[model samples]
Target: MSTVHHLDPEQGSLGSQGSVDLPVDCGQARLLELGYKQELTRRLGPMTSFSLSLSAMCFFSFFGGLPTAYVYGGPVAAVWGWVAASLANILVGLSMAEIASSYPVAGGPYFWCLELTRNNKKYTLIAWITGWLNVLGQFATTGTLGYITVKHLGVMWMLANGHVFSNAETFLAYAICLLLAGLVSSVPAKRIQQFAVFSAITLVFGGIIIMILLPLCAPKLQPATWVFSSFFAWEKEEQGIPTDAWLFLLGMLASQLVFIGFESPSQFAEETRKADRTVPKAILWSIIACGILGGALVLVLLFCIQDRDNLLTGEAQGYAAAQIFYDVFKGRFGNGAGGIVLLAIPLLSFFNATVISMGTNARMLWSFSRDRGVPLYKVWVVVSKRTATPLNATWAMTALAFFLGLPILFSPSTFLAMGSISFAGLYISYTVPIALRMVMGKSFPQGPFKLGMPQPVINVGAIIYMIVSVIVMLLPTQLPVDSNNMNYTCVTVGAVMILVMGAWYLPYWGAKNWYIPKRHLQPADLPKPPARTLRAKHGGASNGASPSGSRAASVKTMPSTGSLPRVPSLDSQASPPYPSVRHPLHRSTSDDGSEMSVYQPRLQLPDIWKQPTPPRLQRREEPERLPVLREAPGKGPMVPPHD
Candidate 1:
């Protein structure tokens, strides 16, 4: 049996009121690992496999890409917009791979900034900015999706039979959908993953069917004078600028919008098994696959549609693509079946967006709360012990998203306002971490996942994309001179949000109290200490004399007699083998109050920071559990300890 060791409290350093000794069994060494004990069971299986991965890509891509293309660019620019977006996603994938690999945790960039800067003041401020912005950014994105789903569904209902619900129909639909999505998200994480797997599979099959059969069914696919052309080849207003250059740039902006949410996997990295390797791969795989497949689908549809006039006007409608799809499949499968299949894509797209939105927003909220940035820290951050999910955070984001989306439902004109402003806010949030990384230079640590390519290349690419994305996201879709049609939606709303975040920071979440980097690894995970046997020096216990040796005495076990005798008068060499110096009035007590002379253990200052043995492997040993958050009531001023 292994013997357990502990500090001798009597010989240890003393505090003002009490002596300090290393804990023999405080139960804290494994706290980090066991803290999530309840939440671990909620994780999904590891073998998500390639099919599911591809399906996930399709779901996210369709939700993110299709809406942007159909609404702003129409068919021509939409097709080319996908191409630009694909290339941009590659850059995004590379950057994220580095960051995700380095910090494979749930909090995403917020956590990354904290670790990279090691709680430096400037970096702490940046992290604070990133955390709140990212959280709010995700909510805004969810709101945008809510807005789009309601608008599209309402329009479809209106066009079908003119018995559309009412002017308030979209708002009511959005509210219902948001609430329902929240409910789906509130289910345990394990269950949500199971659903995700099913939705992902359906999403992929739907995409393949629509893309493959729809274009083939279009009438006059190879019509005379309907040859393929670049996005810029078609001119709408014949503005002074060169069409190709302007359209290409504009298309780049549109495509970037589609690729904005690709980092959803990284946000949930902690929940992912073997995330150190898988999270980065997931981000890369999804981005590459989506870019390629989505771009191709857009290209095919663009080339097949020759009547640009009808495509742009309300005549083509957004569902014109769906019609093209039905046309191709109906000739062979029968009109009724084909029409249903064509409609399934949009229906699936709507649900896909909802699921993705719920999952991403929930993770963001969980991340923020876990870091203590948000209010209701305990409840919001608490992962269901059974499901390993932050259900409270999910529900909260859903409620907020529904509230934000209420405006769009009441006034169709405000849809663009809500969406564009949300987009701007999200991008601004994204830019915070990226900009700080660039400016912070060499101060940041290299994370587990890194952009293997040269630093200059990666940074330049990111900056370029950021500039373009911000420019496009800020521009208003329309300028109708009404309050609802206010231009530069992103800029207007984003400015207000930033100001609000800044204002909040001053009162409660300031620079000093903003970031506190707790040790993340449990004792079992920490490196082990080297072995050594401490030896006493001259004039020490082993030398048969203490520094003030006067025949140091004991009441119980005495020094061995092999090398010396207790009394000099009785033997020629009469010195104790081991001695303990004692005061004249010393009355050392042993266990059971029997007196003994034994030199108690003392720790070196260098050993103070050494990792302790974990409770799991400690046999009978255990440590005390500390409160997760240690704060006071009322609005007393907050300050970080000097350590």
Candidate 2:
């Protein structure tokens, strides 16, 4: 029905690339309608969105989790537990994706909370809490990834010398990683985009290389009976879990940890092209694809488990998963060098995850500060003019992550500790806005992406899945819950929420009175785009020409009763005003000259309004020619000359 768009300055014979005019960024106007102007560049192409999200989802994390899954529930738990976790996260991803597509803002869940709560000034409490949760969750994720990177680095040290790192060494290694990720994240988003592509390829191909080559190159594979049904039993009495059923539930952590960061894509939405459509696809599909790939990866690692009895006893320098990769290549190739080299693939992928996670978290922090939700809002809200990245926020989160890992020097079980809260914080934050939307009746303005009839069902399912996951994440993996082995999810996330509440009610400076970002949250009252009024610019003017028409046509001045000579219209002359802009201020002369208005002008709209500044007033040479007389009602806005 509509094919008359894209004005051209050149002919087709000169170019097959088509229109030479600069293309409009897809969601810029929509963002203006959302209240805040676009502060970030829409530089991320389609490939970067998907890859960046996948990298955050951590496809390479399967190798790291393999050891834990095998120790508790063996091959069966490692393979199928991941499959079950994938299905659960996919539901959550879909629900979040629908909302992400609708909003496509950088604040992600917290901004959504503000809107779904009806955007009133008092209701910003929901957004405040949600933003704090997301930031804490992201910090936890960065810590977890840092430990994993050190673990991978430990694998290299183990292959060369023979033992895992001491607590001090682990801290030192993680510090190096923190500094590196912070430095990388400080670069412009454009360069970080290239790293995303590399990381995604490494993760997908790294899994493929291991799954295909390790199995074929191994001396032998574990039987189907063992791979599908076996359970490597730990000391059930010591742990007090008492049954394989409970242990399998415990092993679900292996997969759920890898699935938690799919929301990263939505954090990058403001910087992505056609964000309304692209971000939702990135959020949803990144999980579905990563889950399937990770399941295959864990399945392959299970079949290649050559030493079941000694695997738990740190036979391969205390890294149980690295032992499987070493034995496979050592059996066939007479050296573990190939295995070590290949293992670096996933390790580097985790490094990429670290950088990207820091980047997304900075964006969320910047957005939260923009709404005055965080302390020193002015400091964090500043974006770098040179790189256009949130450098201040990036460095702040990176420094805080260094502290989160400091606990590792005191506690041995850094993985189980940070892992618990990482998943819990993200899952709980994700649940809030989805629940608020459901309470609002789920009937809002649809964006480029919407679930239609299935939306409500998916929303409910995501909420349930997240709530259950939060509970599971809080459960202690070990029985004798002490300082070292306890699941600190409750303590860490609970303390964070209390601090958030303190900021909320802190007298005059609190967010309670000031947080009002989602002013247009209620769908019924959301601002609509203004209708176009000028329509005489197209054929009347060529390229680089001013719009044609009586810019004074709509001037609000005193009207006269006489009919003026008919003027030429752009429409009759095959001219149409540019659809994207309003009429500008100018004066036009007719064949039979007469003033646009008899008396002086009364009101003038400003140019900033697009509004097209009001037509200029004319001053007579003698200063007596113009009159101040008012015209009668129901008359055309023109005057007859008194010659």
Candidate 3:
């Protein structure tokens, strides 16, 4: 039971005014309804949230993957494939926005799963699976970003020198990239906001610069018939594929990478001000904006292709776009200038993407740790006292990225395999909660943001798209796969699922106490307050008080009531007005026959306010004196302590 205070008009007016001045109360009230406190600072606005999502998507950086699309389905596949993927991703974002609006927690999809299946016996198990998969997917994303940065740097190095380095040198470069990303991520949040803004500026203006330069500087552009009508051509015939259709379908997977990280804004929901409204807009706008920008960039690159045969023959060291840039700009601007400009965009874009990925991974890990869903929760959940950021979780994610990227030293194909796993894990995690919400129909809680009548259709469409994405991601990219190049996505995803379920069900692991969400006790569910007996103010043997004629403090009792009072609005300025219940102070007589009051610490409010009385007090005899009254050197009399 809680105590409620009655306020006069002035006090009530202050409360009402405050509620209007700062609307965080509304967000907090929604969180309380979902059984959580506002643990993270709400400092991010809509632009900051959108910037982070755009940086995560990093569409310009993913131009490296365009070669794969071109190889499988020719120029037409690269264009149409991105359009189709963007449409599907928009549907996914909308469905997620509806759910995010209702439960805007840092746990994001996992928290949604918990709330959606609140009454089910298996809610904990489902939530656990969703969380782990999300973590793994984030780790894979970080690793992939690190790997891309290293590979792009290596290409720049090759342009500088004439030879390729050994596997050891490549590993060192990857480690350096991961280290740099971690350092950038550990900066203060204020700096991170600045970095996010800079990233957005660079993405927009930098993409425009490249698009303009590529067309103007090229000696001769590809014909429109070839660029737009070459849909049925298969550029890669050495893979020993049985049919063109299978190869083209495999090529479509590259489009999936363009919009992979659109869900990043949802991960920062706890930190964003007005999250219910901001997050959905951020998610939708980032995807649509990236889709438009990315599609335009692809068309510009395809039109500027000078020699398709040279690019397809691995002339760019698996980054055909780099070869196109070198060919176009080297003639007009010189090799040194062209190489620097060409490499700078991806390098900067990858670095930006890496920092955003690290931040997202740390937030997700911290949220899971707060719920006791991971090992070593005590260490992982520690927020820095100075910055209020999860420093420990940030380093943990960096260490995991380093460990995951170690395979690049042995097999370059490992990066591709990890990318596939990331695509699969994140999409599956997304599909589950949306599917559950669809199954719940009208019973599901609709948040402030809704898809209205087309919600069910959108939800079902998103699920089917995700299912196809997962299947496509797990398939081998090339025919006649060998040990080194075989896709390990299936094996990696299976291992993760098995590990998560085993930990959940195993008897040795005491997960139930920590991982399960507790059922919140609302004010109405509390026990009623007991009746109190009132006696005459001057005298009563039943009421505990000092002996008659002694200097005793008067006790004021509240009128007895059956039900606990409603809790006052949190925005109210006035504290609850309960009667003061003071205990008798002990006195000791000195040798000069002067009495001194013994010091006693005041009691604090109990956990449950509506209880009949406070808990039994334990008396202490310490000599740490608290002054009841003090007499100044020239004051008339001793003054009592001010309230």
Candidate 4:
């Protein structure tokens, strides 16, 4: 049996101690085999992937959400509900990881959808729908994070100055936060990523500090029974929770939302080496890491609740988490100094997660735009020559995120309540492809990181979980649903889907003409295959064939949409190897005038196609031999018959 190889961080690949079976840069080769050339540097390992996922987890969301749990089902939901949500997320992550391992492409969700449905003619329409789901999901996520960042800043100001920040002031602050996040994302520097990693480190350590301090600083700890079995019954009738079960589901949203974005790491597929293995591992472990810590943190918080009375009555200065922190610190130390320092951790988490998420979003957008599925595709697809980044796509993503937050200014809670919109978009994006993959029944290639026998179970379970989560999130948080407390998820998510349909059928101007990406092997099903051969004898060109009896000259006719022709092996014995083809230049007119690009099938060959025939293969002159005179008497006449 072969031993598992550890990742070599510097080289960005797995290093086996024993004899190797695969060739160098096999991941890169596989990517080409999948029909796209590797453009991003494949230097990320499992650790980086984990960092990305962990960074996107947003510790602030967990803290803010804990109160929601307490108000609904108290310590019981905060503790057990977290466990259920984590398990559900793991199932979702497992399903996502399975596909990510197989495809290992940027913007994997919709790409997987396109590939899984390749046999169907309506794949374009399906992919178009899934693509917007991913885009809108990512936009809502960034918007949510940005809006929350403003809320955090507002809370800090209120605590320090005893003045509430106005909605307009909050709007201006929100704009600046998003703009900064966007600009930072567009910079296209590798070093910028390290800052994000640092932010993740801060979150982990901050959680540790909070965990250690919560019990030590508490006036007294609750009994094991209270921590595990007891539920806080809220007397407020306006909450309108009909039953404990309903409240429990509502309370679980924080855990569910915090866990949802773990799939974001799959967007880093191109950048991670051994991506089939590394990315999936990254995705699974990231959630596990967050879950483990989040669970412990929840336990500590539940056991250390000093005053539930202060919590139910006061608004906690408009932040539920702050009361918990301040109350614990004030009880032991006579001041909330420790709590003040702890509050700042989420700020670091905010900065870290915002950049990490936006980067993921930009990469995904860039990949989609590369397929010409996005509007202004030419602009979004361009890579900045100097920075080697998809800056245009980054800026475009940032702009949409900015606009998505516009509703926040008018009614701050609208955007917050509409948080379910993010969940709907993200979970829906995940559900369709996984469901399709299941229905498609294993025709597509499997990657190294498969779930084996449990794959079917995992995929289906994930679908159920996500569908249920979306439906739950779209439901009203409280029963007395009014305009102020209503959930807008149904309207927003439906509206987005309707827009996608309209775009697809919008007469001549719609996405009917949008480029539908085909599989690397798909064009083989076409009338004239991409890789055709000419079996000519000895010397010259066959009818309608190149003079060399090979495809070197006909390379010009290969369409950009198809995969590169099957390259002949140099050492093959079946036939002499064909000479290589160069990347010939072509000019295409765009809004930005004429730009030269390497004509596709996108392969780079060593030998030039425009070379003279090699001497060995040249035709040889032969001495004319007279046809044997079968008729002995007519031998002389047979020679004179020629004019």
Candidate 5:
């Protein structure tokens, strides 16, 4: 029933004059319970949040990378590998949902880490590292999405025209794609949400269309046994790795990549309505949707393969899915019809993926900068007045992604190496907070939406899965790794870790002062106004006055209690009626040069933690009094004024 007054940052004021009532629900109340006030507009409902997360994951885009699994471990790796990775990722999503419910902030993992660590210095350091790592991961993911979209475009071009595009042309295309995605991200939040929803619908129906059309059009199809039961065994000499088992494990990267960005909902927590409940549901549901849809797509693609040797060694040597599309539709229908479908569906999905990725990156950067977690925090934290979005962070991230993608022009291997760090960085960032939560054990505060009794077990499993994923990502993809084909993900990850750690220790960085203030972690640090006061001040109709009336403008008086209501602590177990602390009496020189003892009330932890309520005022029942008319000096007396 409480009215929430949203802050207009650009105008440096609270509420809009003559604005309608905006109820403050438990979700927003939880945000206030934390240190931050609601800055971003909560326009995203549960469906929009789910669509955003699903778009970021972009399972349909996973088709672009399916060839990696096929090459590494053949049919079984591409099929079953997806199933295994999806299950592990579900665990990760669940663990993050539990934390996201407790601390539903745009700061995401960083804020959760701060809450989990409390005031402990060592754990605080861990929280700082988590924030930087998360920022890096987001940047890397953005770059990767941009790279993939551009790569897909280049492949599509080669497929249509029968010519391989050079790396320079691909880089130019990458820049253009990044620009387009940036533009999409800079739109208003509602528009962005709409775009996400549209993209998700297109992806789902497009996937279904592909699933149906490919199976129906194929002149010859692989037998059920080959599609579901058969495993394409590989000799040690034929695989990239030394052993078949290692190769299969390496092939799991394809599925792992699809699940990498499922944490997108948590990053958009501030923008999502009813974030505590909605965000967790979105996270869990998106994973389930992606797993089911992605698994089906993989199975369809696998079954529709009519010629394995042609897919692996012929004109479609590197791109099997593209080959399947060309062979199935083009062979049955006309070449033009098949080409149109290929460009329309998967290519469009890639474009949507890039835009969503860029948006996610901007949000993470803005959240991090809001806490002074990044250098040049002032510039990045500026939200646009026009779009009500983080335009600066959006463009900055686009520029960073552009630069990160520049290495592609030099060598595809180098670009792949750098881009691969995103997978490792994201998993590592996810692991840290979950690990801390497990360490905190019973002391950790459970949010409204939680895993109940199985949280600890799930946390342990998620940590283990993340650790394995990180290791797999770091391992070299090819045997006898040389400069040309070596995986530099480990080197990149190590360098980033060193840089972040070194910056924290360096005096010039001043991380100790700005990283994460201990006060921000305390619930009492932020105190909200009473519900009635907020309604009146914000000009809400619920206050029983016209929004523009003088009654709405006038401030209501509180009872003469001589003390303010206590602010509530996050700990529900804390007893009510918190006691106040008194400061020691200090002797001060008075104006007459006499010493006087001055005493002041101090805010103790318990006092600040207590929940505050508005004091009820009794209405006066006396009859209205008439105003007395005053006569001007040396003039006739005036008539009395009526009440």
Candidate 6:
């Protein structure tokens, strides 16, 4: 059934001093390869497809913080702020797309830093700092989401009945949300992808349905005069702020919070299939579409607001757009049924955000762990054999997400305030790696994707965003710095605090435990040897090289002893040593017009040993020459060589 060959002991041998055994594959070597392939599969397609794009839109829609922006800069600034942010968002997306194309790994900004850094000692310290800052940034985003989730649910409950949730009710709601979010993300990576796809689809359509149904169902709709120009027009002087200053700075700063997640997809690039292409596409599509949709929906609602006083002054007044929609529905459609449906529209988005957010967070945590940045390297870096998901990272993020949500019970604004602080921190965090990319002249490994833009164009885009982000981060949330000012100091302090945490990785701690810088292992780089089986007794190869058909007739066999070719073949003759199949790229030793194994383009080891030795039997020292026999007896054992 199969070809079998036996060793000839008299022919030749491997000839070694110690025992030789076949190499084995085990441990992280196996784990690394398995994880690499699994992550590749994840990046192949968008988990949420178009819906993820919509969630991005919905996020900015309810930035209730805009009122604070309005309180500081007036309505004129708020309108123009959206314009600046939209353009800035596109630039930010492109810069990140470039980074994703290069590194295309889960480590995101930090990994990019690791690759681009010139000096390991200095750049590594910087990259490590950026890594944990990213971790904090994730926590900040989760807190922000928690605040929004609680705020909206609270508003819905109030509108349904006429009461706010008591202290106990508030804690229970946050606890429930945290637990549910954790459990959902704790599932497998593929499962998360599928769920994200479904969530993205639902949220995108939900917004579309709301936009269509709202204007159609409203009894007294505004004419074109009121809808566009008038709604966008604002009286800046009434708000006591310079229109130019307000529009340029206040609006730009506030809008950054909503656009924060535009680069979220990049965190999963390593897990993405064809990341260079898919990640950049997903990011650009999400930002452009979401930016347009968010601006349009807010403007549409601005047209429909009948009473500005009631809109901004209600007990739960920050959510004027949502409340206005609900009020209109109740007044025109029926007894509160239509209004409930409208409220449910955005709420559905939170559901999608809940799952996707956890997925992103878990991926970031997993990437950090793989680099040994986290405390538990072996356990945290492990991917679940069954699910191929980072189970430990998921569990850890879940615990952290719950703890972060705890502040909500003490102060309603705690989570919200923390998010505002975190938003700036994240923007600052984003700028560092991007600045590094621009300063350091390097690129990531090429995959199926690349930013179609010229390098200079991409660099300029990154630079503009960096300048704007810094300017915006410095703006006061509640301007005029009175006792009631929003204390923008928190953002600055938080960012500084995050950087300070890097001190642990300074000379004493990081240097001691950190060995030489290790490159992330790729599949092709693993240790591998020629697939040859040793003969049982002779120790020579069992199946000596075979001529692969076309050159078989011209191939000459040679006795093996780990040495170079004994003699060269003449013209028209075949080469010896069975036409070596090893080291295909290397030139064949044959000097004659003899046939050899088809010369492969790739390089390989030559069949001849670099270091040769005498055969095992010949290695024994020869005995001194013995005396000659019979004829020499008379001379009483004369030396043998005389003849």
Q: Extract clashing residue pairs from model 3.
A: none
> What is the C-alpha lDDT profile of model 6 across 400-495, one tens digit per residue?
767766766776555555555456656666777778776765454333445554755766776777666766565554335565556544654565
Winning model by TM-score:
5
- Listed per model in order, the count of residue pairs whose N, CA or C atoms clash below 3 Å is 19, 0, 0, 0, 6, 9
| Candidate 4 off by > 4 Å | 1-23, 232-238, 518-643
Per-residue lDDT tens digits for candidate 5, residues 353-388, read 888888888888898887667878889988888888
**Alpha carbon lDDT of residue 125, candidate 4?**
81
Off by more than 4 A, model 5: 1-23, 239-242, 334-340, 510-514, 518-643
Candidate 3 segments exceeding 4 Å error: 1-25, 232-244, 333-336, 478-485, 510-514, 518-643
TM for candidate 5 is: 0.80
The order by descending lDDT is 5, 3, 2, 4, 6, 1
Comparing 1 and 4 on TM-score, the stronger one: 4
Error of 5 at 475 (Å): 1.6
Q: Who is ahead in TM-score, 5 or 6?
A: 5
Which residue pairs does candidate 5 place in steric collision?
Answer: 567-609, 567-610, 568-609, 568-610, 568-611, 569-609
lDDT of 3 by residue, 264-306 (tens): 7788887776677788889999999988998888888899887
**Global lDDT of model 4:** 0.70
Which residue pairs overlap in candidate 6's backbone? 43-271, 43-272, 43-273, 44-273, 48-197, 51-200, 77-247, 583-604, 583-605
lDDT of each: 0.54, 0.71, 0.72, 0.70, 0.74, 0.56
Candidate 5 lDDT at 596 equals 36
lDDT string for model 1 (1-643, tens) is: 1111223432221121232222111111111221211123314433342222443334333433443454443454575566666776677567666666656666677766765565576556667776777776677777776665665565445445445566576678878878877877777766667776776666667667766765666554644233234334333243223444454555455566556566676666655654556667777777776677677666666555634445434322445554344344444455424544466565656656666666777887777675567767768876666666777788888888877776664665565565664555556655555565666566654544566447557766866777677776555444334455445465557676677556556666554454453433332322222123232223434334324754233222223212111111211211111111111122344333435423332322234344556455577845897545545679565565555
TM-score of each: 0.69, 0.78, 0.77, 0.78, 0.80, 0.72
True lDDT of residue 348, candidate 6: 63
* TM-score (C-alpha) between model 6 and the true structure: 0.72
Which residue ranges in model 2 land beyond 4 Å of their true spot?
A: 1-23, 232-235, 242-244, 414-419, 479-485, 507-509, 518-643
